[model samples]
Target: MESQHSSTTTARAARAPLVFVLAAAVCAAALGWTYWAFVQTTTGQFADESAWQEAGVAAPDTQLPFLRFLDTLPTISVVIAAAAILFVAVRRHRYGAAAIAVAVIVASNLTTQLLKNVVFDRPDRGVATLDFNSLPSGHTTLAASAAAAVFIIMTPRWRPFAAAVGGAYSVLAGVATYINLWHRPADVVAALLVVGIWTLIGGLIIMRTGNRWNDWQGFGTGWASSRGWLGLCWALGPGSLVLSAVLYFSVQAIGPAPVPGTATLPLFFWWGLAWIVGVGFTLSAAAGWLFADQARRTSARAVVP
Candidate 1:
């Protein structure tokens, strides 16, 4: 039994690096595809423009609250990430993990800015929209990276709950940017992918370097690590994808051709919102699963005397 457990742990640890690499590669590819599809193609431009235009139809009463949330988002994200990193470094004595998490946040945000301003360019695709490039939204990147930073510093037992809450906050931030006409749907999705890439890299480092505290018994060990939280994310992620597909096709079947600046049903806005929710929860669940699996492997190895 001991030998079998040891072999299992060895196999899992061996596979961990490959898994993280593949996941990060997927994120990078998705970021590239998002930019190409939404910023470089005519059809993509039309869809993006349609979604942005639809935001103008949002209920007037909701604008103030969203605006206020955006106003506080920067300060709130910075404070929360800073506090979490400090706790892990000072109290938990995981200085290396904390430093890696901070690097993830800063590097992800800086990458987004570079891609949006310097690396990418918006050409005249004959879509009557702004000519400036905003492929990876700075605000979305900031919010997602902050959430990811908190998630990284948490123990495996508490990670599921953290993932769900943080994912929801990131989704809300992305949706707010979309509804407020500050960014298109593609920009928000790209930002999420960018953070995801950095998070995966940072998480792999934290798992390897901070293995002492990374172990956990598994899900349901506590309220925070309960299966219920992970189940919620599982449900929300797929449900939002289905909802987005339904809204998109239904709108296409019923509505006329999309014309810039023309008043239309808010279905496009809802579709984009659903996409944001889906991406956020999906990434959240994936991250939780990855860290949990790594922690389990670490725990198994610790007992392999």
Candidate 2:
């Protein structure tokens, strides 16, 4: 009986699929981001071939090198790298996990930058032709890669919160990239693609790690259970964003929409989108809370019978 129980636990752990999921996350993030960028910039450049101008969203102007540098910092990645190393050292007691994580992280950076150049396609000096390869963004790859690294270490109980935090960090990377370079805003969104894919992938990979993040779900951890999962997303992520977007446009139609060289409240309206979405950052985790609560009640009823 003891051996059987141990084996069951081992099987559950194996299902986490950490490395495989990491690779999957990388593929999703990279491919999705590349698609988005190509559509936004490459397609535009292709049309005007000579303009070398891509029809994508340009980043807002800013002058904060220090902040930009901070945003680009690989702090989260470093921490994750450490955690992965520590886990292997303690549990597996092998130096390989950490080594692989570090190598992947470093290699991902190179591949990411290479892809960025290819997709964004800036031309040589005195060239009037449009460049092709800048579709998949490099900075985005970096940001996403970092997020992926972090997600691998996160517990499911921490998944929602960790993902949100990861999103915020990726945003920081975007800000830094934007301030330093006028790279397409679409390019920055590569970070979003990277992080989202990994979070989803890594979430599934290590779901059991956070089987019970707490005695009970706490702040940021969503209501437990399948229903809670859907409800959390509806209440926060998509639903809230939809609400904010509607409100933004409604205000614009009702009042004066900020036009170019105008008041720029519309930009604030845009930022409002971010604020509303942030709710999902926490509420999504709180989603799991409902599931646990329901299960407990069911177990209680069964016992009473």
Candidate 3:
């Protein structure tokens, strides 16, 4: 039994890095596709621009909150990430895990800046917008990465709820950037993907290094690790995507053709918002599942002795 368990453990450990690498590859591919579709194509540019134009349709009373959130987003993100990292380092004494989490945060943000400022460029596809590139939004990157850092350092049992809350927070930050016209939909999505890639890489390392603390007995072990939280994430992730598809198609089927420089409706804005929610929750749910599975396998192997 011990030999069999050891063999299983070895097999799983070997496969774990491959899983994370594949996940990161998916995010990278998605990021590339987002840039190609939204930045390089005429129709894509039109849709993105229409969404930005419609942002002004938001009520004056409602705009202030989003604006304020954007204004203080950096400070809030820093404090939250710092507190979480400090807790993990001091209380948990998982110094390596904490350091890796911080590295994920910094690397994600740095990669975004590099992609936006140095690697990417917005060609004039006759979109009648700013020529400077903003495909991967800086604000969204900071928000998502910070939340991801916190999520990374959490115990396996606590990670499900943490993913949900962190995902919601990141979604709100992305939507705020969209509503305030700080970024287009693709920009926010790209930032989420970027952070996701780093999170996977960082999480794999942390799981390997801190395997003892990472073990868990699957979901419903506690309030924070309850299956209901993951269920909610699953529901919201796909539900929001369905909502976005329905809204977009329904409007196209019934409403008039969208005219430039005119806010016919906030269809694009709502559509963008839905996409943000969907992507954020989906990523969160995926992360929770990955970590939970890894932890459960670890727990199983430990019991064989």
Candidate 4:
């Protein structure tokens, strides 16, 4: 009995740090995003200008209809998405997972509201944009929170595919906001960080509450266990970062005159979008791996004498 207890303790200890790491990652990303948006003048201008440029690019008559539909995507869509995810969890008889999904959605959206409305003030940082508080976009938060909730309720075997689909949904939503000129890239990034933090908490809760339902079958030949989705994100994430860095320096080398509202902003805007998407995918892949690892440990423990 003592040995069994010790083994369980060891497993818990091992899993705790992964949770801590994910939580810490959210904090770090949030801070870094803030500093980039508010402090770094050049970077801020690039993102701001690029956003307007992206809007210009999407302003064509041909794309306006689709863009308009995406822009008008009501809050009810978020509610419906969350309800659908909750139904999946409840149907699986994973009540804890359902609760965690709800908590993550609520907490993440609340955090975005708090930051946008009360906590953070947009001081006159001498950037070439309106002096309004736009950090942690509400729309991006809505989309990312829904996606994170879906990821939490899925079983380990299905998580990889869910992570891929969910991450894509989130990235598309964020980019759509950008195309419509609703938010800056930093706003999207901040929202992603907020959702990531809440998702980590939800994942921990699910790990403890429904280990049997989330058992990690060994990585066999199937696409789910093969982890092809994770592998794609892992490669794309770093590759996108490298591409963004290269674009940043190349643009800097040209030293385009700080002409406010120039057509050149589109270049940086697309680059910023890519960077934020990479960040989202990277976090999704990491979270998926962490959950699978925890479930695997639980499965091993169950089989032991």
The Cα error of candidate 4 at residue 45, in Å, is 3.9
**What pairs collide in candidate 3?**
none
Instruction: Give the higher-lDDT candidate: 1 or 2.
Output: 1
Tell me the RMSD of model 1 versus the true structure.
2.7
lDDT tens digits by residue: candidate 1, 87-203: 989998999988999999999999999999899999998888997998899999999999999999898888999999999989999988887889999999999999999999998
Provide the global lDDT of candidate 4 against the true structure.
Answer: 0.71
lDDT of 3 by residue, 1-305 (tens): 77876855763574267888899999999999989988988767767877777776744456789999999999999999999999989998989988998999999999999999999888888777878889899999999999999998898878999999999999999988888888888899999999999999999898877865776757776789887777888999989989987876765576524563365567777777788899889999998888888777766766664
Query: Model 4: per-residue lDDT, tens digit, 1-305?
Result: 88877666555544565665656576667656664664355556555655555565645453466476566655644775667676876576667777778888899899899878887776665556667778787887888888888888887888888788778777777777766777777777788888888888778877766645766676667876568888877776767777776766666677644653465445565567677778778877777777777777777766566
In the range 1-305, model 2's lDDT, one tens digit per residue, is 67656644553454335544564556465556444433445332222221112111223434466355655465645665567557755775444434444554566666556556643445443323434445434554565566555544433344344444554555555545444443434445443454444444434433334333212232343442124444444455555556645654554455532232133333432433343243333333332333234323323332331
Error of 1 at 262 (Å): 2.6
Point out the higher-scoring one by TM-score: 2 or 3: 3
On TM-score, who's better, 2 or 4?
4
> Could you tell me how far off, in angstroms, the CA of residue 295 lies in candidate 3 after the best superposition?
1.1
Top-down TM-score ranking: 1, 3, 4, 2
* Candidate 3 total steric clashes: 0
RMSD versus native structure for model 2: 8.6
Query: Which is better, 2 or 3, measured by lDDT?
Result: 3
